[model samples]
Target: MQFDLNRITRKNIQLLKPYSSARDEFSGEAKVFLDANENSLGSPLTKWYNRYPDPHHVQLRNKIAAIKGIAPEHIFLGNGSDECIDVLFRCFCEPGVSNTIICPPTYGMYQVSANINNVAIQEAPLLPDYQLNLAHIEQLVNADSRIIWLCSPNNPTGNLMNLEDIETVLNNFFGLVVVDEAYINFARQRSLISLLPDYPNLVVLQTLSKAWGLAGLRIGMAFAGMAIVEIMNKVKPPYNISEPAQELALKALDEVGQVNDMITLLVDMREALAAVFRQMPWVEVVYPSDANFLLVKMQQAHLVYEFLLDKGIVVRDRSRVELCDNCLRITIGTEQENTLLVDALAAWHEQ
Candidate 1:
């Protein structure tokens, strides 16, 4: 498909002049700094923090580029994936005029971000089997449809959307196709990042929050064509990523081997937990998962959720969510923690 970013982008954003920061103005090595109005005296906690973080995340993006096998120019850093979602809406969806499509029983943030940006939403609910409804999606696309959000190893469903289905949308859609891969680290499927050369409209979002265990750092990444990356950079705040966050992420990225080991362990625990649940008479179904969590349909699932809560164990009650009736979403915890959960569930089963 010929994806004309200019055709889809909001007019104001296309013509907008981005804010120039003190850091953006200077690039050479400098011993003395007078520009950003930092105190001559250093900060109380850390001397380095007195100065502003890099407005562009140059160093961090380079590090991530090396890891993801992409050029630094293709990456856009955000405070979190939430920020990326909101920025996409601002850049592409003109408020009230432009609309985006989302498959139901997917991530809640996509709809939340769209609503916050005053962008109309069109629903294309997932099929009964938890895959994209391509025909329904195609029907919903109109001239104003600027984005279609897909979640892989999807949030509540915990299964990757079929690769063929995703490519069909990318092949057909004229506007941007955003594939949020928050749980990609756990999935066996290859990320859509490699397809950037083929699809200019494809925007792949990943995060340090999941496998890297850096949720508190609030770092999210959006990989897209240079055009989309440039627009996202223009819309984001000057210092969307803090100096500490950048530093911590840099350190974490160096430990890929360790993270991979943890991922293996989590996957093991997830399967073990699922096996135990499968044997339980109370568990109606233990949905297949490519993510860190499991979506389980059980007898009186809400009561089971309450029972676990009363014992100080918490799991998501997704019974109210579409296609997940009488279901609970459970994240795979450490071995000991998983044992505690199983013990609690066994007790509930006995009751």
Candidate 2:
């Protein structure tokens, strides 16, 4: 399934001229930076933050490209994966003319972004078990469908959609297939990133927020053929990533071991907590998790949720979300935090 790689995306985007800053015109070692006006005296707060940052965030991209084994050109850094997701709809889907296919009981932002873009949405709800309904999805897509939104180990479900199912979509859909892997790092499944080169229509979304513990940094990375990336790069704010975020994320990358240790702790906590939740009589089921969170089904979900809130423990109430009735989404916190949650639930059940 080869796409024109060079073709297909919005026409307005191709003819658009991106604002060029002095920094945009140059890269590599420079003696004295006289680019986008910044205090040469340096900020009183931080010397490193004196200047305006690279619009393209090349350094951060290189670091990520090295880690992900892809060229920096194939990457587009956004304020968050949300931004990239939004931009994709903005760039490709023509308002009132094109639509996107989303599997609901999945991520809400996909629908939100599409709505904001004024792009129509075609729903293909996940099967009862929280897997893609490939047959239904195929039926929903039309000539106007320009994007197919997917979330692996999906947001509320905590389950991975079969890889083959996703591949089938990519192979069949002529539109851009945006696979949101925001939670991929926590999962053992191989990222859809590797499939980018194989499917030009593939766009894999990732972020530093989850695995790297840099949510405040708000850095989201998207990998696709350079063509799609270039289009997004043109549309995003010149300095989408603030200076401090770039610095912190880059430094965080340096301490890769620390990040791994944190993930290991969280993964261990996730498993331990899963076991505890399952043991509770009120807990009907604890969905398997590959991400930092768990989606749990309980007999008295609403009552338990209110009780936990009363105890100052906050977790998502996904009960009203389709296919997740009476389910509560819980993120694996520190060891002590998990203990508090477990104890709270146990006490609530006893009451």
Candidate 3:
């Protein structure tokens, strides 16, 4: 309940004086720029890209803040949500000494990032129904554990973690509780971003890669208390987001109606796909999903995966992931793509 950021953050990070760009000092309109040693001549490319991108992501964050109803100061735009995850480990977890909690059959990056940072990972796997095992999670929380990772509308599983269970962790654990909401735009539930003011230790991760259809642009957002956001900003590389990415993201944000319509179409297609999978004899289970994908258990998952691959249709083989045995994670593709997938499966069935 009482989250003291000073106590939790790494000592070296606490004292660290972040790299400040020339842009950090002056914030206003300037006719001619001579500050950061950009070529006075424009770039060879048609667009002006000779000057460095804004390190602070001022315009982009302000646009996001207006939409999310949060202050720009509380937002940190990373190269991807993966960057935000990595920065948290660097800023909080002391290598080898500090540890973090990860509920596996969840996102893979949390484990990968922890290993890269040399932070110990404690696994508190999801329960039988693919929900949080809160008691086990609470019991795993020790003094050395610095973060707990939760993925809602979880990857591979395609279900949202219960909000009450999340609140329980936030209340009991003094350390960081990162809720990855990468697929939140497709979910029915409201985002925990609205509760950032209530929980200081909470960090909500989101991305443009999913419903926004901007994976190539690679813009991810971390919404947290200003204290956490400031530290993340401090640790990140200057110009983490490219000028083209920012420009495109701003343009995408203005087309919320288009994004929403796309999401509605995907959700409908997801349901339709699930119905088709259910009718197939090989599909043992089609798990309930609130995201843009479905996790279906196949009778012979590897064979099915190989079959799909040979047809030049790609879907994730998540059969090896925990609690997702014999599963294929299928994204809700466009109408034609989905038809191709079903037709391929039907062809497999005929043989």
Candidate 4:
């Protein structure tokens, strides 16, 4: 399918001007702010809370640009990656007129987001090996299919899709290829962020939530061509990220050594947990992972899930998803947490 990038961005969006706050006009140092209406007395919540945040989040984007080797112009920050996902639909896709394609047994939100936007979701379920079905996906795309959501080191399966297969989709598809790399920091493959220059429709979404252990901070990032990102920026509410989140993320970026150390630790723990799962008598298989979690297949997923829940060891039962039978998506916790999980499984099996 062929598409001219300019022609496909929603008509209303192309003509519409984004709301401009007074702070947006002059970005340099400012004092005696009277721009946007705000409490003259600083809010008790936080001194920074009294004022509106940088509607564009310029400083945060630059820090991310340096780390990712992408330009600040290409970066977009959202309340979470989910916001970025949701906005893409609103920006380019016309509800009931446009559609999207997603792989099943992947992130549920991709499907959920599409549904919420009234964008019909078409599926080209991943092959039985849990890898992308490129041929099938090609068949699914048409003029109305506006985006394709691909999760690398896919959510419940815990496996990275072949990069070449993804490039195939990019080469052929006219619409945006949204790669949700929420877990890419844990993967060995180089990010497709570098491919942004190559594919105008490509958008790479990452978050500090996963690898940096800042899920609570709710900082999600999307990197793409400036044109596509501009549409998203237009739709996103101003002051999306709080000042505290910006402050903490700035601090976290400085603590790269600590974050890298933690990744190493989690990788070690992940492997240890994989080995333990392999030794369990009821365990059928432990899928290989490039993320912080394991997908373990066992004999009785229901009983095992219930047992773990009883013991206060929470894990996802993803057996209902296609190609993932009797599988439990287990996040690698601390040493003590993993030990308790292992012991719980051991005791459950003894009964």
Off by over 4 Å in 1: 46-48
State the lDDT of candidate 2 residue by residue for 1-351, as single tens digits.
Answer: 345533456778778898887777876688898876777777668455877788978789999999899999999999999999998987888888889899988889999998998998899999998889999999997777889999997998888889999999999998899899988878889898888778989999999989898899999989999888989988898888998899889988988888888888888889989998888887898999999999999987888889999999999999988899999999998888888999898888778
Candidate 3 runs further than 4 Å off:
none
Worst 10 residues of 1 by lDDT: 39-48
- The total of clashing pairs for model 1 equals 1
Best by TM-score: 1
- CA lDDT scores, all candidates in order: 0.94, 0.88, 0.93, 0.89
Candidate 3 vs candidate 4: the lDDT winner is 3
True-structure RMSD for candidate 3: 1.1
Clashing pairs in 1: 153-160
> Which candidate achieves the best lDDT against the true structure?
1
lDDT winner between 2 and 4, please give it.
Answer: 4
Residue-level lDDT tens digits of model 3 in 148-239: 99999899799999999999999889899999999999898999999988899999999999999999998999999998998888899988
Question: What is the alpha-carbon lDDT for the whole of candidate 3?
Answer: 0.93
| Candidate 1 per-residue C-alpha lDDT over 1-351 given as tens digits, one digit per residue, 9 for 90 to 100 | 467999998899989999999899996799998998988788688545888899999989999999999999999999989899999999999998999999999999999999998999999999999999999999999998999999998989999999999999999999999999999999999899999999998999999989888999999999999989999899998899999998889999999999999999999999999999999998999999999999999999999999999999999999999899999999999999999999999999788
- 100: Cα error in model 2, Å: 0.6
TM-scores for all predictions? 0.98, 0.95, 0.98, 0.97
